[model samples]
Target: MNDGTTTLPWLVIREDDNGNRYRVGRFATRAEAQRTADSLGDHEHQQLYCVERLGARKPGPEQNGTAR
Candidate 1:
């Protein structure tokens, strides 16, 4: 969003099922990010995944877990 130049930090969460896929949220704020994670509880079907995916095509490396 906003030309991939966010003023606040962002977070991405996704859930995979078989060959199918489900994305939780791409939050502009840290609180929203945590909220998305909390919604996806410890369920087998609900495969929770977090990534510090910077909103940029030339993004640095994606951190393959929840943000610190």
Candidate 2:
């Protein structure tokens, strides 16, 4: 069974000089995510911004139509 809900697979991540990472945002498309990362990276040289795709996840109860 498929739920109507969709997940944003593209992630915009930020890594600081200390090597700590933070999730900036999620997007439906890679282009949107990358564009945001590039703009943010241009402003902050010390922090690295990049786009990554989330790994596939198994459908949970909600997605399986088990939960209300």
Best model number under lDDT: 2
The all-Cα superposition gives candidate 1 an RMSD in Å to the true structure of 5.7
Which stretches in model 2 have alpha-carbon errors above 4 Å?
56-68
lDDT of 1 by residue, 28-68 (tens): 77667765665565445556456454564423335344422
**With candidate 2 superimposed using the best TM-score fit, by how many Å does residue 4's alpha carbon deviate from the native?**
1.7
lDDT of 2 at 64: 21
Candidate 1 residue pairs in backbone clash: none
In model 1, the runs with Cα more than 4 Å from the true position are: 1-9, 15-23, 44-46, 55-68
lDDT of candidate 2 over 1-68, digit per residue (tens):
15887779888777677879788899998888877877786663567776777874534434321100
Clashing residue pairs in candidate 2, if any? none
Q: Best candidate, TM-score-wise?
A: 2
Worst 10 residues of 2 by lDDT: 59-68
lDDT of 1: 0.54
